[model samples]
Target: MYFERAHISDEELLSFYKQLLYPRMVEEKMLLLLRQGKVSKWFSGIGQEAIAVGATLALDKDEWILPLHRNLGVFTGRKMPLQQLFHQWQGSPLGFSKGRERSFHFGSRQHHICGMISHLGPQLSIADGISLAHKLRKENKVSLAFTGEGGTSEGEFHEALNVAAVWGLPVIFLIENNGYGLSTPVEEQYRCEQLVQRAAGYGMRGMRINGNNLLEVYHAVKEAKGHALNEQQPVLIEAMTFRMRGHEEASGTKYVPPALLEEWAKQDPIRHFEGFLQYLHLLDTEKISEIRNTLKYEIEKDINEALSATSPAVSIADELQDIYAPAPSAVPPPVTTPVAEKRFINAISEGLRQALERYPNLIFMGQDIAAYGGAFKITEGFSDTFGKERIRNTPLCESAIVGAGLGLSIMGYKSMVEMQFGDFVTCGFNQIVNNLAKIHYRWGQNADVVIRLPAGAGVGAGPFHSQSNEAWFTHVPGLKVVYPATPADAKGLLLAAFADPNPVLYFEHKALYRSISGPVPEEWYTIEIGKANIIQSGDDISIITYGSGVHWALEYAQQHPEQSSYILDLRTLQPLDYDAIRTAVAATGKVLILHEDTLTGGLGAEISAWIAEHCFTSLDAPVMRCAGLDTPVPFAAELEKNFLAKTRMHQCIQQLLSY
Candidate 1:
C-alpha cells in the first residue's frame, strides 16, 4: 500500500491540474468581489490546488465528492459549470445557497458532488457516510472528502477517521496539509512529525506525499482508492503542500512572512507541475505553451461566464428544492399490519434492515453502525447481512455526515444518516438547518433525506455526549420532527420517515436505550409520520408526549388508575397532528405535554400554543407541559435525572390530574 517517490509518465498526474489554475484565477476575481463589498467572507483553496485537481482523477464522476470551502478547484477541474460557481461567489440566485446559505457554500446534487462547509473537519465524516451508501449500493464508487491540516485539530476529524477505519468504509479522507489552520502555523497547530501518522491512532495506515506534486497527489489517491474500495478501509493522505499567498484574496500578509511567500512562490504548483510534465517528456514546449494559453482562456471564460451567467436565474422556486423525500402514498393501507414482539433497539435495527430489504434505495449510515453495530449495537450483524454498502459506519464528522446525507438523498437514495451523539449534531447545524430544512421550501420539496440524532441525557454520558435539541428542530418549518416512545413506533415511524417527502429529523433518546422497551412487530410496519400516537385511553387528563416522555406518561397512566387519563404521543413535532391533539384535548379536557429537551422552546410549548389556540373551548382547566430545565445535562446521575423529563413528566401529569 506504499509507493516510492518516482517521477514517471505512466500516469499523467497533471490531468486535473491542467485545468485547475483557471479556478484559481477565478479565486482572485472572487477576492475582488470581497473588496467590492459583494461577498462578506471567502475561504479560497488557493495554494492546495494539486490535491483538489489530482484527487478528482482517482474518483469517478458518478462517485461522490464533498469538498470543503478550501477545495473549489476540484469542481472547476472536474468540469463543474463555471456559471454555478460564479453564482456561488457572487451570492447570486444561481449560488448554491439560494439566498439562504453563505457564499461559496454551494453543492449540486445533480452533479453527484455536494457543496462544502467552512467549518473544519465535518466534511471528512460526511464523506465517510456517503461512501457507506455507495458501498451498500454495491457500487464501486468511493466518496472523496477534502480538508486542510488545521482541520485535524477537530475531534470530528479524529472521530471520522476512527469510525471509518474500524468499519472499513469505502471513503478516502484527503487531508490537504497546506501548512496552516489560519494564522496559526501547523507547527503551532500540532505536535506531530507528520499529520498522516495521526491515522495510526485510529488503527489506520496513512502516508505523506509532496502535496504540490500533482503526480504525487494522484499516486497517493490511487492507492487510497484501492485501500478504500477493495479493502473497505479508510486511508489518510497528508499532502505536504504550501500556500503561496494569504488565506483569502482579501487577507493581509501581516502574519504570513514575506520570505515564506517568496519560497512558496518559487514552488508554485501550477508552474512546478507543468514544468515537471515537460521534464518527464510527457509534454513538449509547444503543449506547455498551449496549456498555459488555454488555461488562461479557460479561466477568463469562467470569470466571464460567472459574470455574465445571467445571475443564476432569479427564482423563488429554487429555494423550495432538495429539502425532503416525497410524501408516502396517501393510500398506504388504512388498516394496521399485525404486530409481533421484539426489543427496542432490535425494532429500529430490524425496521431499517427490513426497509433496506424492501427498498433497494434505502441506506443506513452512522458511526460504528455497521460491523461494530453502532455505539449501542443496534446495527450489529447488519453490515455482514446487508453488506457494508447498506449498513455503513461513517467518519465522525457530524456536519459532513449530514451534508453528505443531503447529497445522496438528492441523488435519489433514501439515506438514514446519524450523528453518533445528538450533541454532536451541533457540529453540523448549517447542513441541518440551511441545507436540509430549506431544500423543500426552496425548490418545492426537492430533497429526500432523513437525519437521525441519538439524543437526550442518561447513562452517565456527561456533557459532551448528551443533548436533546428537538426543540431547535421544531422551529424549522420544512423539517418533520419525529421521536418515537416505543419499539413498534420506532420501526413504524422510521418506515414512514423514509417514505415521507420532506426532510425528517428522527431523534432517538439515548436514555431509552433499554429503559423504554416494547413489543415491535416482526412484520414490517410504518407508523404515520407527523402524526401523534396515543398509548393509553383516559378521561381525567391528557398526557401528550413523544420519545422518552411518552413512556413516562404511559407509566403514570398505569400507576394512577385513580385517574382515567388519555395519552397522545406527538410522534412528530412538525405538521403536528393538531387535529389529533384537539380531539384528545376535547375529550380529556386537561393536557400535559412532556419532552426531554429544555423548557424554553421545548416542543411542548408549541403543542400547548396550538392546543390553546384551536381547542381552547374544550379545556377544562389549563394546558401544562413538563420538560428539562434550561441547563446543560449535568454528569451527576441524580442531578441529571432531577434535570430530566422523567421527574418533569410526573409533575406535569400530577398537575394535570389535580386540575
Candidate 2:
C-alpha cells in the first residue's frame, strides 16, 4: 500500500485523515452560515485543505507560519480555539485583532501565526525576516510562507525569493498552484511551465507534488524543512491543487469549466484519504459519520458563542487608538554642555554606533552599508565595530528588506533601514505604508523599525535623488515623521527614534549632511518626539518650518533682525507639536509656513489648514506658505536655484511682515 511505502503507522495515518477532515467539515458549515446571513464573508478552502493541514502539521510548534486567506487549515491545524476563529470571522471583540480586522487578515503572536495583508507578496519578505531572526539567534527554526500561483507574478515575489536565496535564509516558500488567482487562470499568470522551475534561477531547491495526496504533501514539507535548516537555504514547493469553490462566496466560479470540476471532484482529499484508511481496515462508514457529526456539532457550538459576543463599541476616541504604541514617558534629560562639534552626517553615524553598542538586538540594513559604508557613508566602519551580521548589506530589494524589518520587530528586534537616497523609497513604498505602518494598528504588533531617509534638494543631485518626500509618509497614519536641521537634533532625534516603539521615518537633508555642523553631546541622549523646538524667539511673525526650511528661516531671521520672526522647527510631523504651534501663533499674530516639498499636497498645506482651523482668532493676517514651485526639481544649477523655495522665503516673509 502507498501508506506502507511511506512508513506511516495506522495511528499516524488515521490522525492525518482526521486533521484533513476537520477543516473540510468546518468549511462546509461556514458556507452554510454564509448562506444563512450569519457570517459576513468567507474565503472557502474546500479543495485546498490538504496542503495547509499537511504543511502546518509538518512544522514544529515554535516555527512561524504566514498564511494567506485560503489557508484556513493552518489556523485549524494549529488548534487555535474554534471560538476565537469564529469570533475573528464574525468581527467580534474577542478575536485576535480585537475586531480591528476581518477574516484571516489578523495575526496571533501567541500561536506563531502571521496573517497576510491583501498584498500577498510582502508577507514573503516578512518571512525572510522571521527566518533571518532565527539565523541571528542561532535557533534551528524554519519559517514557512504560503502564496498562490498568481501571487508569483508580483514584483515582491521576485524580490523576496532573490533576497532569501542570497541570504541563505531558512524559509520554505509554498505556492499552492490552485489553478486560479481570483478568477485569472494559471496560464495568464506566468509563461513558465511550473512555478517550481523558477526556483533554479534563485539557486534553491524546488519540488512539485500532488497536493491532494495528504501523505505526499506532509512528507515533502517535512523534508523541505530539514533541508532548509541543515543547509541554511530556502526551498520553493509548488503544490498542485484546484480551487473547487469560488475565490469568495460572492464571486461565483462560472469561469471554471464543468469538466475540470467533475474530474477534481473524484480526487477529493478527504474521500481519497478515507479510501486509503478503509483499505487498511483502519476506518469504516461508522467512523466517518461519527467524525462528521462531532465536527459539525463543535463548529455550530463555537459559532453560536461567537455570534453572542458583542461587536466592538464605536467611539470617537476608540477610532484613534492603537495607531502607535504608548510613548515612553521617562526620557533621559539632554546634556546642557556640548562635548564637541560634528557634522550632521558624523552625528548620525555616531548615534548609530552608540545605539548598536547599547542594544544587542539592534540591526542596520541597507545597500552598500557594510564594507562600502552606504551610499552616503553613514555606516562607515560599522561593519568593523558591529559584525557583518548586524550591519547587513542587502541586495537592491528595498521591499523585502523593509518587510524583513517588520518581521525582525515581530521577533523582538530593533531594525534600522537606510534608503541610500530617499527617492529610492518608492521601490519599497508598499511594504512601508501597507505592511509596516498597518501591522501595529491591525494586530497590536509594534513595528519597532526606523527608516533613515536621505532627503531634500539643493545638492544638484537632480530630481530622482533629491526629493523631500517626508510629506508622503507624514500623511500616512501609524508612522512618526522626523526631519532634523542641525547636527545636534539629528543625533538626538535618531536616538529618540530607536527608543520609541513605533515606525519612524527620519529624514536627513542631503544638503545638511556635510554642510551643516553644530555642538553635539558625546553621551547618548534622547529628545522627546513630537516636541517642537523654538530655534529663535521673536514677537512679530512666526516662521514655522522643518528640515531645510529651518535653516532658511534661521538665515532670514538673522539677516532681518527688525522683522523679529519666531522660528519654530517641527521635528516630528505625525504627532505634530500642536501645543507649541499654538504657542507660536499666540506669540506672533502673523504666520508664514515654509517647507522644501512642492506647494501642493505639502506638509505646509496641512499645517496651514490646521492653524486656520484652530488658531484663526489669534491670527492678525492670513496664514501664508512658502514652498518649492509646482514642478519636478531641475538638474541645471540655475534652474534648481529658481525651483527651490528658499528664494521665495524673503518675499513670503516680507508679505507676512507687512500684513
Candidate 3:
C-alpha cells in the first residue's frame, strides 16, 4: 500500500530526482566540513532525504513547515539559499539565526518555517497552534510538522496529535520512522508494529509510506495535504526509512550493528531513486555526472563565501539586550483616578475585555476559557462578545497550549493564555522556560505572549492547587514576572503585560482574585512593569512584599503604628525595583522581606543577597524573611495558615524593629 509508481509529470519526476540528490550531496559535503572543523556538528538524513523533499514538495508555498534537525532537505527544497545554510553551519552572523544557533536550529520568518528546538516533540504542538491560527482566519493553508520515531514516544507527541484531531485542524504529522531514536532501536521505543497505528487512538487517519521511495512519500503527503485542506482533517504519516549515519557526527555509529547498516545501505533512498530515474529514461551516467558537478560547484562556492563572512562579535550587553522584547520608547503614566469599586477578578476580566476591544490581533486561550469562561470565570461572556475563534477553549494540554500560544505570537499575534491553576503550570514548564523564554535571545524572535498564572497559597486549596511559584519564573532570564497586589494593579499590570513585547508571566494570586476589592479605573491604563508601589509611608523599617504579601505587610504596619513600618509592593519580580529596595533600606536601616513561597532559594534569598551586596552599610540590622515553610501546602485551613508566612509578617516586622 505504501509503494507507488511516479504519479507526477515527466518534468516534475525529473525534478524530484534532483531534490532527493540535493540534501544527500549536501550532507556529504557537510560531513567533510565537520571533519575539517569548519562546521560544528552534522545530523545527516543522507539516506532519508526523499521524505523531506517529498513532503516539502507536497505542501503549498504559503503553508508552514515545522522542521527538525535532520530535515535538511526541507530547507533546501523550500529554496533556502545554500549560502545562508552554509553560513548557519559556519557560525556566521549572516545566517538565519544570526549565529545564535548552530546548524538547522533556526527558521525563516519569510518562508513560514519554524526552526525547531532540540526537544523533538514540542514542535508538533506548535505547528498545531499555527494550523489553529490558519483555521481561525478561515484560510486554506495547512501546517506540516516533522519529527522522528523516537519523538512519537514523548507526551507532547500525543498532546499535539490529540488536540489537532479534536479540533480537526489542517495539520499533517510526519514521523520519520528511521528505526533508531539516537542509539535506541525502534524495538525498544514502542511496542506497536507501526507508529502510524497510534493515530487510531487520536481519531485521525494514519498512513505508512516507504520513505526511501520518493514517489510514494510525495503522493502520501500530497494526499494528506488535500485531506487537511478540504476536510480539515489531521493525518499522521509514518515514513519508514533508515538513518545512514549516527544521530550526530560526534555520536559515533559504534552501537549500530554492521550487518544492519550494510542491509540499509542497499536501500539508500538516493541510490534507489537514481536507479529508478534511469529505468524511466530520465537520466544516464552523463546527465547524472553533469548534474552532480554543477551542484557540487554551487555548494562549494556557497561554502567558501559563508566561510569568508564574519562571525558575530556578540558582547554581554548585546546578548542581554536580546534576552527581552524591545521595550516601548515611552508609555503614558498609569491613571490613578477611581471610576468604580471592583474585585481583583473583575479587574482582570475587565482588563482582558478592554484588551480584546483594543487589539484585533490579541487572542485568549485556556482550558474552559470560552463558553465556560475559564475555571475561575475570569473570562465569563468572552466567547459571546469576542467570538469563539478569539476566545478559544483549549484541550487540557498545557505544554501544547503554551507552545501554540508561542507559535501564534511568532506569527504576529499577541496571546493571553491561562494555566487554569498556577500549580498546573509545571505541565507546561518546558514551553515556558525552554522555548518561550529563549526564542528571542536564540533567534531574534519575540514571543509577545502573556501567560496568566492564578497562583499563591490560601483557601485550603492544597499542594497541587495552591503553590506560589513566582520564584520559578523569576529565575528564568527571558520572562517578565508580574504579581499585582491590588485591584488597580491587577488590571494595570495585566494590560501592561499584554502591551509588553516580551513573554510575561502575570501571577494573579488565586486567593486575592475575589478576596480583594478596590477602586479600579474603567479607562485603559498600563502600569509600567518592574516598578514598585509604596502602599504606606513610614520610617523605622521597610516591609517589602508583593501579591498577597502586600496585604499582609500593610496589615502588619497598621497594627503597629509605633514601629513606623513602610510597605513596599514590588509588582514585578524579574526586573525587580532594586532602586526602591535601596531607598527603603537606606531610609529605614532595616528591611523585612515577606513572600508566600517557601523560604530557602526563594526570591527573598536573591533580594537579601542584593541588599547585603549593595545596601550593606545602609542596614542597621540583618535582613529578615517571613516566608512559607519549606513544605508542600497542607489541606486543612489551620495547617494551611501555619504553612504560609502571611500570619508571621507582623512578627517578622517586630523582630526587624528590635534589631
Candidate 4:
C-alpha cells in the first residue's frame, strides 16, 4: 500500500530491493569471516539496512554523504566496488585507505563520500562545509551527514545543527535512532520524546519516520532533499529503527531484551519489504531465494578476491613518505622590490589580503571575523572587501569551525581559521589533531587549512589568553608549525604557510603584534617554511629561538655586546632547519635554546635532544635551555616576569658563554 502511494516503478522497486539486500548479504558474509578469524572486526548493519540503502539511494550520486561505521549499505548503494570494500575490511594494500584504516573509517572523494572518524559528531560540521561549498558555487547539491541518537549529546552536534540553520545551508542531518548507543538506551540518552524535536531549537524543519520501512525512508529522505535544495535550508530527520544485532560482531546482544528483540523481529525490514513485493507480484518466494543465492555467490567471489589481495608491507620508510603530500617545488623566487617598514600585525593583515586576492577558493572562518573584524581586528576590513561568504563570521564553536575548514579543504577550498587566542585552540584540538592532521595520511586527502594562533606571554593577559601552545601541534606529525619573529617573516611565512598543501599552525605572538616593526617586501613574496634566519652572526654562543623568544635573544645580545652570540631565529618549528641549526652550533660550539612554552616537554627539549645526538662532537659545552617555568602563566606582572624565559636569558647566556 505504501509503495503504491509512493508511485515508484516496479522495476525501480525491485532494484531498490536488490540494493537493500546486497549489504545484508555482505554483512552476513563478513560475520562468517569474523567468526572464522579471517576479518579483524565487523560493525553489523544487518537490521538497519533499509535506512542506509533508502537514504543513500534518494540522494544524487554527486551529492556528498558522511556515513557512520554501521552504514555499510551507504557504501554498497553508492556503487563502491565490493571487492574494494572487502579489501578495505581485510586491510589489503589495494583498499581505499591502502590498509591504513579499517572498516568504513575511510572516505573516497571520487565517490563523494567522507567517512566518519571514531568520534561521531565532528562529521556533521564537516558536512556543513561541504554544503557551504555547494551553496557558494550555486550548485544544486545537498550533503547528508549521519549520526546516531547518542551522538546528539556531544557539543559538536549542537554547534553543527545551529551553524547549518544559521547559514541556511543545503544539508540533510540524518539521525538513525536505533534504540541504543552501544548498550545505553534512549531513555538514558535524551530527555525529549523524539530526537527530531531538537531541530526546532535550531529553527530548522524536522521529520520522524519508521526507519525499518524501506518505502517510508526512501520517500522521507527524497522529500527532505527536495526541501533542502529548493529552500537552501537544513533539515533534521530522525529515522526510528532497531539494531537487530549487537553494536559489532564481537559485542554480543546480551544487554538487549529478548522480548524487544522478538517484537522487532516480526517487523524485519527485509521480510516486510519482500512480503510487499510478493503482494504486488514484483517478487515471489522462488525469486527471492534465487536473488539471495546469486548475491551470496557474488559476495563469496569478492571475499575470495579480497582474501587473495596482498597485505600492506611493513615499511617505516614508505609510511613516513606517505604521511605528507610532496611539498610544492614550483615556489616563486622571492621578490627583491622596494620595502617598507610595517608592524607585524599589519604585515600579517597584508599577507592575508594578498592571499585572498590571489586564491578565490580561499576562505576565512572564526568568531566575529566578518563585520566585527575578529577578536584582535586582524581581519578588520576583510569581510567588507571579500564579502561575507568568503570571510565568514562563525559561532563560538571552535570544533565545528575547524571541521568545516577541513571539509572546505576537501572540496578544493583553502581555509584560514583564526583562534581568538592560542589557549582557545583546546576547544578545537580534537578536530585539528584527529581529523585534519590524520586525513591526508589516512586517505591521501589533503587538508589545506591554516589555523592562526595568537600566542605568547608578555602583555599580562594571564593563563587563559597568553599561553604559547604551539608545541602541542608541533608534536603532531601531519601539521606544519610556523612562528615568525619580525614583520618580514610574518608576512612572508604566512604566505608560505597558505601555499603549503598540508595543515599549518601559524603562531603570531600577541606581544609582538604591534611592538615589532621591520622592513617587509612591497610585492607578494614567501619565505621558506622550514628555513631559519640569522639575525646577527657571532662565534661565542648560538642563541637559537623563535617567536617572542627571538626578540629576547636579540635584546640580551644587545645588552652584552662583549658576548659574541649567533642569534638564530627559527621561523618554522615543525620541519625545523636542521642544516641551519647544525651550522649555528658548529660555528659557536656553545648553544642555548629559548622559548615561551613550558620547559619540560617543550620544543626546546626536542631541539636539545636532536643537537645532542647529531651535533655533540661539534659542541664545546652542553646544550642549555632558557624557557618559561612549568606553571600556569601568572596574572601579576612580577610573577609573570619570573614565569617567562626572558627573566632567565641573562644567566643562561652567561653560563653558556663562559663554558
Candidate 5:
C-alpha cells in the first residue's frame, strides 16, 4: 500500500528515500570512522541500498530474517539503531545482546530479526524452516533470507530450495545479483540463465526485478508474501543489479577494469531514482538536499555515539553461554522405560518417531529415509507411518540436505538429520562447521541440530564411503559428539541427544547398525551422554574403546580368558567419562586405548593422555594406544580390512597384559 502504481503513495516514496539516504550516509561515516581508527572494521552494501530498504518495508515486525554478509542496508532498514550498528562496527557490546556475537550478525529475538552470517548458502536453508514454522504456527509472518548470486552454486542453496519448493514452505529466497563474487563473475558461478529460473524445477515460482528500484522490489516482495503465507510455497526473487562497488569497500575492483565500473556506476539506482522522483514531483532538488543534510547529521551522531558507548569487546567465559542456553547444572532427562520396548534399532526409531509426538515442530529428513527406510534403512517404514511431512527422501546434495535440516533446527525444530554414509558427511562440512557450529559461537544461538552419521571404515565401504571423520569435528567447539556401540546404547544415546539442547553429532557405526542387533525394552528410555558404559569387568588391564573398537576389546577379553581385562565403551567423546576411565585404570594398573581413527590425533590418544594424567599413579606401565595407520583407507578388501581394523588393539592389550 506504500507505492501507488504499486499501491504505494508519494509519502512512501519519501520514506524510502529517507531510509536509503540514511544508510548511505552511515556507510560514508563508517568508512571515515574506519580510516580514523575509530571503527576497526566495516563491510558495505553501498550501491544496492534501494532494494534493501524496499524489502524491509514489505516485512511484518513479527517475521524473521536471516541475511548473508553485505546486507547492511537491510539490517538498518529493520531499524537496528544506527548507533548500535556503528558501535558494533567499533567493537562494542552495546551492539550485541550477547557480548560475543559477530558485529553484523545482530539479533533482537524480540524484534524477530534473527541474525546474519558471513558464510553463504546455509542461512537460506535455515530460512525455509523458520518460514515453515510461521506457516504451521498460523502466524502471518514470512521468513526471508537474502544472499548474493554467487551463493547459488552452494549445495546448501539447492537443498533449501528443493525442500521449500517440494513442501511449498512459506519462505522467500532473495538473490542480490551483484555482478561479482569476490572477482568471480555470475556467469562463472552458475550455468542457469538466471538463478531464479532454477526455482521452477523445484516447483516454486520465480521473479526478477530491478535491484536499485525500491518501488519494484517492494511491490515484487509484496506479491510473493500472499503465496508464501497462504499457500506455504517458496518464491525466488532475483534482484538484477550490478555491483557499482567492489564486493566491499576494502575489496579493490582493479580486476573489474575501470571501463566496467563506469558502465555500472552510470546505472546507480540512487542517481536513477533521483531523476525518476524529480520527474514525478515526488522528490526534487530542494527535498533531496534537505534529506542529505539531515542524514549526514544523523550519521555523524550515530557513529560518534556508537563509538563512544562503553562495553566489553569479548571475554573468555562468554564462549559457552548460548550453545545450549546454559540450563542449571542438572541431570539429563530420564529416558522413558516403555512397558512395551522393542529391538534396539527399532527402539531408537520409535524414540525419534515419538519425538514428533512430543514436539510437533520436530521433523525427520534424509535420503530415502521414509518408505525406503533411509540409505541404511535406519528410518525404514517411517514415511508410511509418520507420513512424508515428517520423513523425507532428499536429493543427493548432502550439503543442501543437511543445510535444510539445520534451517529447521534454528527455527526450534527437533530435526533428526541422517546422512546415508558416514564419509558423505564431509560434503556438508560447510553447513556443519560454518553455520551449525558457529551459530552459537558467532551469535550465541542454539541451532538445535542433531546429525546422525553412520560412520566407521568397516564392511568394505572403501575410501570415499568408509572413513571415520569424528576427529575432524571433535576439534570444533559447541557440538556434542556421540558414538553408540550397541542397540541399547543407540536408543538411549539418541533419545538423550534429542532431549539435550545443543547441536549433536550422532555417529552410528554402520558395522553395528544391524550386525549386532539386540533386545531393547518396549518402554521409552534415555542414556546419559558424557558417561561411559562398562561392558565387562576384570582387574588385569583396562581397555577404553568406542564404536567397533568396543567389540574388538570384548572379543579380546573372551579369547584370552586367563588374563583379566576391563572394557569401557566411551559413548560420548566430547564430554569424556574421566571418572569411569580413572576408576578402571586404578583397578587394573595398566591402560590400553583403542579406536578406528588414525593414530596421530585419534580419540585413543586423548584417552591415553587422560590415563597418563589421572591414573598415572595407579598405572604399572605407560598407556598403550592402537588405531588405523595414518593413511587413506584403501579399496582392496583384504588391505581395507587390515588397514581399518584394530588388528593391533588385541596385540597392544597383550603387551599391556604382559606389563
Candidate 6:
C-alpha cells in the first residue's frame, strides 16, 4: 500500500502513484535518448500526468482509450508493458508499428488503445462511431477520446460531439486544456472563457475542472461513465492544465512566458498531489523518495533493454508488405445463372442489402441514406428494411462520416460509407488519405470500411457533382480502389470489398447508374478485387480502361470490327492485374489507355508507363492515351460534350493504328 486519504483506499492511491511516476520517469529517460540522438522527438507530458492517470484508471479494461502523443500517463495507467513502450520510442522491431511510426503514434489492439494520426480532431469522430457500436451492441462500455484544447477548434470536434449527442452514444470527450497549443496560448485560440461551454451547443453535458486535481478528474470520469452506460449520454470534460515542457524537444521554452512558467510550476500536479498525501499522513518523505527511485530504476532498465533491442530489419519487401490484409481463403466462384437484369444503382443497393443480411455487424451510413435513400436513391428502403440503427442518415459532415466509419471498423464492424457524389470526397480527404488509408500499415489494424463514391460525368452534373476522382485514391497506398462498369461487376465487387479486410474505395460511375443494365446474380456473390475482365477479345489493338471509359472503349471496338480491338476493363485499379494487362499487350501489340479523368497524372498514365517499361518490346507502336482535358469539367453542355466525347477516343485510336 502506498497512501490513503479520505475516501481513497491505500491500494488505489498506490496505483495512482505508480501511474504518475511511471510516465515522468519514461519522459525523463526518453529525453536522455533524444540528447544522445537515439530517439528522434519527445512530447513530454510532465505537468499534465494527473488527468491522463485519473481518467484512464477509471475506465474498465474493455473500454477503449484513444490518446494523443502527449498522454504517456494513459499508457502507463493502462499497465502497458514498459519494454514495448520503450521499443516504440526507440523505433525497434518490437514496437507496435514495427518502427513504421513515431512513439505514441501507435495503438495496441490487445490493449484496446487506438493509434492516433498526427491530425488530432479526427479521432473524436471515430470515437463516436466506436461508442455508437457499443450502444448498438448494448455493451456496458464507454470510450474515452482525448485531445488538446486547441484541437476543439477543428471542425471534426463539433461534428463528433453533435453526432454522439444526437445518437445518444456512450463516448466521453476529454479535452486536456493544457494552456497552450505549442507556443500559442489558449486565450488566442478561442473566444470561449472555458472550452467545456461549447458542449452545450452540441447538446451534451459539459464540465470544467482543475486537471491537476487527480481525485477531481477521476470522480468526473466515473460520473461520466455511469451516465454513459446507463443513459447513453455523451459527456465532454475540459480539464484545465499545462504542459511543463515545450511542444517537442525542438520547440524550446523561448515562446513561453517566464513568469507564467513559474506560476504553473508552483502548482505542479505531481508535487501538489504529493503534498496532499503527506498532509493526510498517507505518505512520508522516505516512502515517496523510495517510490520515485524505484520507478526511475525500472524505467532505466527498460530503456537499456530497448536500446539493446535491434531495429526492424527493413528491406524493400518489408516496406511493400502488409499494404492490404491477407486475402480470404476461398473466394466464391461467379454465379453463371442470372436471376434478373438490374441497373447499376439497383445492383449496388442489392449488393449492400446482401452484405447487411450476411454480416449483422455491417452498417450503412451517408447523408439522407435512411429515409431519403441518399442523393441517388441507392439506399432506398434501407431504413425500413434494416432499421434506423443499421441504416443511418448522417449529417452533411463528410469527414466525420468517414472518420466514424473508421472508428466502427476498429470495433470489428463492416461500415459502408457513401459520398453523395465522388466529388465531395475532397471534404473528407484528410480522414481518407491520412487516417483511414494508413491505419493498417501504421498499427497492424484492419480498417474494413468501404467508401462508396458515385463518380464520373455524362448527365450534365458539372465539375462538383460529376468528377472521376479514382486517381486521387488509386495513387495512395494502403487503399484498394475499385471502379466497376457493369451492374454485375458492381454487385460482385461491392460484396467482395465488404468481405476483404481492407479499406476499399468503390467508385460507381453515376453515368451508368440508371442508363446501363446488365445480368446480376440474385444470390450473394463476390468477384475477386484485383482481377481484370476482357469484355471483348481481339488481336489487332488493346484498349485498357475502367468505369465509364469501358463503355467508350467497347463502343469504339464494336464500331471498328475490322480492326479487331480487345477491351480490358480494370475492375480494381490499385492491385491492378498486371498479368492480364501483360497478356493483352503481348497479344495485341497496339495499346491505348483511356479514362474519364484529366490527361495528366491520370490512372491512364500509370497504365501507359507500366506498358512502356514492361511490355516495351512487344509494342507494335507507341502506347497512347485519350482522356479528359487538363481542365475542370465544364458546366456548359457543349464544352462537357467535347471534353469527354468518343470523337477524342476515335482520334487517339486512329493515330495509334496509323502509328
TM-scores for all predictions: 0.76, 0.98, 0.96, 0.98, 0.90, 0.97
Per-residue lDDT value at 231 in model 2: 96
**What TM-score should be assigned to candidate 2?**
0.98
Q: How accurate is candidate 6 locally (lDDT)?
A: 0.87
What lDDT would each prediction earn against the true structure? 0.73, 0.90, 0.87, 0.90, 0.76, 0.87
Candidates 3 and 5 compared by lDDT, better number: 3
- Cα displacement (Å) at residue 436, model 1: 6.4
Write model 3 residue lDDT over 1-659, tens digit each, in one string: 23367457778877888888888888899899889888888888888888999999888877889998889889989899998888888777778876789888887877778878888888898888788888878888889999999999899999999889888898999999998888999899999888999989999899998888888888999899888889898999999998888888788789999998998888878778788778879899999999999889988888888777767676788767889877663244355654899999999999999999988989888999999888899898989999988998888999988888887876678898899998999999999998889888777778888999888888788999999999998999999999999998999898898888799999999888888999888888888898898887778988888999888877766766677877889999989999988987887888988899999989999999999999999899999988999999999999999999977776776777787
Model 1 clash tally, residue pairs = 42
Query: Lowest lDDT 10-mer window, candidate 3?
Result: 329-338
In candidate 5, how many Å is residue 524 off?
2.8
Model 6's C-alpha root-mean-square deviation from the true structure amounts to: 2.0
Q: Residue 530 lDDT in model 2? A: 94
**For model 3, what is the alpha-carbon lDDT of residue 659?**
73
What does candidate 5's lDDT look like per residue over 244-334, in tens digits? 6656567767888788778777777677777777877988778889889888887777666665667855666654555554422323334
Candidate 4: 10-residue stretch with minimal lDDT: 327-336
Looking at model 6, the pairs that clash are: none
Model 2 spans > 4 angstroms off: 1-5, 333-338
The 10 consecutive residues of candidate 6 with the worst lDDT sum are 1-10
Error of 5 at 413 (Å): 1.7
Residue range 184-271, candidate 2, lDDT tens digits: 9988879988899999999999999998888888999999999999999999999999999898989989999999999999888888
